[model samples]
Target: MAGVAGRLARRWSWSAFRSPVQVTCSQAFPLHVSGTAMMATQADFENAMSQVKLLKKDPGNEVKLKLYALYKQATEGPCNVPKPGVFDFVNKAKWDAWSGLGNVSKETARQNYVDLVSSLRSSESTSQVKPGAESQQGTYETLVVTSDDGITKIVLNRPAKKNAITTKMYHEIILALQAASKDDSALTVLTGNGDYYCSGNDLTNFTDIPPGGVEQKAKDSAVLLRDFVNCFIDFPKPLIAVVNGPAVGISVTLLGLFDIVYATDKATFHTPFTHLGQSPEGCSSYTFPKIMGSAKAAEMLIFGKKITAGEACAQGLVTQVFPDSTFQKEVWTRLKAFSKLPPNALKISKEIIRKNEKEKLHATNAEECQVLQSRWLSDECMNAVMGFLSKKAKL
Candidate 1:
């Protein structure tokens, strides 16, 4: 039996690189001619048995085949040409390869591999489809939409560039919010499409704004963005955000206006206005400290350290953190639930909350616009912007 097994192993191994039929026929013929049954010692038998056990237990077909081939190639020359059909060795090999026997058959390992492959394939397909899917398809660089039940979702889509607020994008956002306000939609969910929600202003425009005498242009852009933020804050009906990634600058500050905010474990919240040599915008100076304590908000605005989603939840910046995998689904589900509530009740409730703060928000926005306009032309802000661009250019 041992001799037959050894010969079968060698034939299978050689066949892996050659032809299975030829090896099988050749090995069988030699054994018939020898007329003497070759045998193996107890130790040799044990070692060969161990090899079979390993082959049966290996999870991967490629790995098992390689090991089987190697074992055959190593032992075949020294072993005898054994009798045929002694142990059904080929059947065992096939069974092991297909079954993924022993330690490799655990449910957890299989599930892990399945999940890993799913994520890899999803990412690959997304990368291939993403470039052609946006802008060229009339999707626009800074706009996204999703729908669930009767709820409609709008997202700021420039996440790779940190959803930088452009003049056109700002105007479009105001239009979207206004449309949502008028529409009898069940809910409105707003968020960013990628890793960052928004990084504030589009610094690229600064490059074209000539070295001097572009103060009015800068002010115009800042006003447009601030107006959009104000419109979003004052929009009627429920507004929720699934902050699955970073929310920086105006993005973080604007969350104060949202009815609910859900962030992911990987989400980050930051506001770096003071560090950028400019005053805060989106009325963050007042709204941020009001939502989060003055001391905590001051620390973040001054230093600009990225706060984790969990920390944001604790600080009242976000409502909660959903697992990264199901964050969006969970957020939309909540939005749909909110949408099911009585529309008049929701509208009145939201108005009551904002009635007192509306005037305050407007005043703050106007003040912020003035500061931003003045700083936009200041040497400090210009130099900082230019420096940032220079570094970005190198990268």
Candidate 2:
């Protein structure tokens, strides 16, 4: 009885002295005070107006509004939260885009997006080379090369910048892969000197790609990288990636084209395309989920999840994960084992495997090139590249 009386008293007081507050979607709210109804102050109206502005700008304002409505209904009597599909209309236009079924009218654009997504999902793992093989060493800018033992080792030498791949480094890699192809080496091992394998393409040259010329430049660059990957893939020997540090974007996806991969405990793998509003590259889509599972691939492609080396190994993306201290020795031992194999036999085996998938690989490469060219000029990619360049300039 006392509680009911208290509630009634408060209600009566509100009705007798408060003005009738009119709430609108805008910043301004009007209130009408009847005779003797002067209890409500200007502060009350201002506070309401501020809340209105917040609701208007909040990304989840609609959701909050629905929740509030549901709360009001429940307090008045009984009600359910608005159905989940209520907001589905807002995303209706983008439904196809998100589902990978983009419109046929925009087929080229859709294909570009699909290809980029695929590249993000691919895994580049190389076949393991046996231990005790001969090795050769080479260096270019921030890259250190160790070849011989039937394997050319290309290591990113920039530990200071986490071994990010620069334009010069990119060209050097093309040269190294070409050399490896001509050599009688049974396998090639690509890794990093210190910690990081290759963080990503250095943003320094991003601004060098001209605005209108971006598409052609992208096509040329993609062709160059594709040729490099093709050389490794078609070589008489296998190619392996020994990752010890963060492999982001292209670095993460390039491994998809390799035959086998070994990573240290400290290695991390991620594709940051979606985060940057850009797409993936390096033929990742076809290879990634095939090496890892489809679900895991989706997680990496969609959310750009950063995966630990152990997680990568468990997902079948990495051939093995070893302690950081023993990783180098173990990798050398494996490479030497490959070097002991008959070079001709290794070449024959590699040729046979590649012959089976040669057509498909070439076709995929062509398709990827087409899409990459289209996306190169996209606003999202352009803006991201520009922003990256600006940030790099500051650093």
Candidate 3:
């Protein structure tokens, strides 16, 4: 509730509520110049405004302030309103942002807004692509894998489904990891689109019984699962997990494989394997205990405990936790800087650190998948999954 209030407060001001001033762009910014060029620019500016609403991710506060300043300047001509008081931080920051524009003409501000929007859209497009520099496979349906600015980023793209990992997603992810390993990027980052980092395996994968029945389905799935996890274990470069929001099941279990995990205060980590009558995967059985110790790890993997970002950090799962409002800006800044380091140096260093555990992780992964194959064929696992899906359909 406090977080909700805080976010609302940041978005609005007491002064705005007390004395509202509304100005439409067309009314305030009357054209000084005549002709098709001015009319075209105006249309483009309005189009840019619409495009801003379509952006997939927040462009951060600094960019938002610039946009606010430009929008106000273009429409209202200048910041004629009285400066907000110091104590009214939200209003004050807004006032400062607008007032800092310093009497720029409305036409220039409109053009600038259009240009800024264009730049932002372009950057976003580049950030979401397949990893290999020369590869033709630059697009994906369930994932975005790009190598740029010294970092290879793998973004889970199923936002409407809370970034759930479908069978197709598992294959794409494995391919992305393989590409990232050979890419020139200094590091690799794993994250997600929209609210969730990942909600874990799509339960629908269980319902679709194949030609060979449940036993064959389990065996085939185990192979894919082993290959998927081995990609993480064998990754040569530094692997980072940016936990933007709540993560569950395999998503939370896999964090222990990452070299660094940065999370927002709003993010949560949970391994609810037991809830579905399943045991742990993603080498969490080995890595979780090593990071969080046996008892705490058991609380999560066995008993289905969910921990907040702070608790995850305290237990050595997450490297750091930042305020939810500042998380993306702060984490991306550090990641970009980290990516500037020598690529080979970072890769070799990560390889050296992972060398001792590589064999053990592979062994653990094999054992876990072998167990999961058997479990998947069990009536307990089948009943639990079916019940969950039944409840979901009702919801």
Deviation from native of the Cα of residue 229 in model 3, angstroms: 0.3
Q: Which pairs clash in model 1?
A: none
Which structure among the candidates has the greatest lDDT?
3
> What TM-scores do the predictions have?
0.62, 0.61, 0.66
Q: What C-alpha lDDT, on a 0 to 100 scale, does residue 351 get in candidate 3?
A: 71
Residue lDDT tens for model 3, 1-395: 56644764567543332211211122111111111122227787788877776667655555666677778887788888998886666566567777866675777667656656655675467557643332333556788777779888899999999999999898778767766776788989999999999999999999888676878888889878876886787677899999999999999988888999999999998888888989999999999999989999999999999999999999999999999999999999999999999888987788778766664676677678888888999999999999999999999
Candidate 3: clashing pairs of residues: 129-145
- Segments in model 2 whose C-alpha atoms lie over 4 Å from true places: 1-139, 210-212, 388-395
User: Considering TM-score, where higher is better, how would the candidates rank from best to worst?
Assistant: 3, 1, 2
The reply for model 1, stretches above 4 Å from the true place, is 1-141, 146-148, 210-213
Candidate with the greatest TM-score versus the true structure: 3
Q: Candidate 3, residue 361: CA error in Å? A: 0.6
Report, for every candidate in turn, its global Cα lDDT versus the true structure: 0.60, 0.56, 0.77
Q: Please write out the lDDT profile of model 1 over residues 117-142, one tens digit for every residue.
A: 22223334444555533223254456
Q: Model 2 over residues 1-395: C-alpha lDDT tens digits?
A: 55644543443332221222211110010011111111223444344334333332221222222222222221222222343353354232122222221121222222222222122122111112222221234335656666555667777788888887777777677656655665666777788866678788776655676767766777677656555444444444677888977788788877876777998898999887776656666667667777787899989976899999999889888899889889889878977887788877876776666555553454455555556556666888778777777786899
